[model samples]
Target: MKNTFNIHEVSNLLDVSIPKLLLWEKKNKLVPTEKDTNGINIYLKNQLVDFPIAKDVFESKWDEEIKIKPLGSYNSIELFAGAGGMALGFEKAGIHHVLLNEIDKFSCSTLRKNRPEWNVIEDDIKNLDFKKYANKVEIVTGGFPCQSFSAAGKKLGFEDTRGTLFFEFARCIKEVQPKIFVGENVKGLFHHDKGRTLQVIKDTIHELGYTLIEPRVLKAMYYKVPQKRERLFLIGIRNDLAEKNNDFKFPAPYKKVLTLTDAFKKGDLFDNDVPESIGDMYPARKKEILDFVPQGGYWKDLPDDLQREFMQRSYFLGGGKTGLARRLSMTAPSLTLVCSPSMKQTERCHPLETRPLTIRESARIQTFPDEWEFVGPKSQAYKQIGNAVPVNLAWSVARSIIDYLNKINVDNRKNTKTILQSESV
Candidate 1:
């Protein structure tokens, strides 16, 4: 019944050599073990359960803990804001929000309902000119939709990227000329169109006189988010800003991993039990079929005849087909919450209940606080919650940005002093 394991057991389970484990311990890649009076290393068993090594031994080493410096009152403007997930995170990190641009009526309403003081723009981004914010905002952030560019012509430029939301995002960056800019997208952006999509984005940022910081795919689970969502983070420092200092780094990963229980029950994530709310209902036939799935079980748990009827040709295909009729496990993070948690192709049934997770349940899994409410109908609410960046994940990233900005400020002061002394000489 014990979830935790010892260091030796972890070494054996991971098939990693003792020397490699020692190296990991030294590099801070593995959890530091407690030491006895005799200096013997002892690791907690539960810590090993969610360690990255146990999940995928070949996983990259990008999940190191990030240190963040607190920078108070740093001004920021967010574009393509959806239900304020990223904005909430930045606020938690002590960043000041000057404006938030969101095109969805429901989402804009949701923002206003929660934080009436926020300057929420409810119009299309293309219609609004950001010239007024020139040299005013310190940071510009957005989660622009990823779209493929025409390959027939030269590499996509700012003009060619027109008619796309990313172009609008780029336009805002140009107009504001913020010291730093952060853009996020799905992991698919990395491989979209043989990687040309990301390449063009980087080139465009360079054209705008900003230095791209080797964009990376940040895993939500690593940052205390209970889902397996991966977001591509694009950070750019204005050329002038980068020349002043180069010590900027991303936020470090949390020491612990969160699970479904963490989201719904009293724990580090939430203080009270999840509030009961309205959710989409399943049809009679689908409900009857889903009733058979046990906690953590999926379509494979159904009767053979039922499997054939439900899966159709997909049953004949390869792999585990894990997502089909999948009931979540309380011990691990919930699978990515989709707009329709009850759909057959991407079912996200409650671990105990036969029905889909409610709108509030979905929001909790994304790290949205209990007070934050979604707007519009049940479906639109689900879409906003499902599409949001995990608020805690955003806080971690924002902390890193604040640290970089502090370093920039310090360097600027030093440079200014040197120029003053030179002119006097």
Candidate 2:
């Protein structure tokens, strides 16, 4: 049937990996109008574009990556710097980290442990003053936890966001007055408070004399992270620079979609297989029930008796509870990592073993390098890794920002030269 291509079939037809296709769908590029009984995406034939362009976009990853380099030295200040995933990635992209701020003690410890040279500020964002960094930092970035602004005010400007963490983020941007600012958060912010929240954000950016590039949700899997995590990015450029030229580009997707095999086994993602580390263990009964579920399978794969025992009353409820008793497939990217792996509604069992993923395994899934260690207890380490942006994904975004900043730097040089020429005349 023309409309019968499942996810696998589409992957083969387009020569793109399953994760890339899913990323396209997330951006509303190639939406599957239907799904098969097995819950696989069923794409229609008419939805596809020509094969040549599709191949170019999906296959030219390495070529695009080789072109990403900073034209000039750029410095950045990072906020909500959880375990330094984004900050590290930016550093790898040739952007220097002038400072990093985080409220979590364990996460701050992790940042300091890995990069002692970094000015790691371990304090609440509200207590800090960003005015000193004005004109000193070119970029400001953060994965600010999403919080709704109060609707009690008439205008949804900077002041309206007060009493929320986002206000602190806004205050930093206003004070620092960086050339560019990047704010990352969950995808749900797009629709939060029936879209009023994002509108307020846009309004606040305008009030701060910056132009907002339309926010986009990037899938980490497409950027070499072996996980299905997604984050929404809001990028703003100072109005003066934007007025002169504003051409910010989002990063290109990597060609290959990695899997748990790439993560846990010796392959492209890692030099050695996942190392031994502390991990959570399933209780006796939970382990017994999950043992029956096969790789890539979930609650439906279990026998009727075990399913009933595991799901309890929810088994009789509607909708497919796929995450229940789920075991990751070695062939596909792992599901989004949460603060804890053994959560009942979102179980993250190992593909082969009957236990939850170890702290190192979780970090690897988030594309955090092995040597980039996490501090504190196992639970805290897991929390830090789970809450981080994928390093490679962050690197991709940073490269794009660098590209734009390079252009700005060239423009600035030209302007100075023109002014000198006129003065001599």
lDDT of 2 at 64: 68
Q: Compared with the true structure, what per-residue lDDT tens digits does model 2 show for residues 1-425?
A: 23456786566445466778999999998889988889899876566545553344445465566477887778899999999889988988899998899999999999999999999999999999989989998999998887778862368888888888888888999999999999999999999888888888888889999999989998887787888888999999999999988778888776556789999999988999999999999999999999999987899999999989999999889688878899997877889999998998999999999999999999999888999999999899999998998998898899888888988989999999999999999
- Per-residue lDDT tens digits of candidate 1, residues 1-425? 34454554455445454567789888887754576566645666555657554544223232432344454468999999999999999988888899999999999999999999999999999899999999999999999999987751486667767778888999999999999999999989988988888877877898898999988888787677887777999999999988877777876655455678888998878889899999987788877888888876889999999888878899899688888988887766777778777777889988877788998899999999989989899889998998899998998899889888988777778889999999999
Candidate 1 residue pairs in backbone clash: 4-45, 4-46, 5-45, 65-252, 66-252
Error of 1 at 360 (Å): 1.2
Estimated TM-score per prediction? 0.84, 0.88
User: How high a TM-score does candidate 2 get?
Assistant: 0.88
lDDT of each: 0.82, 0.87
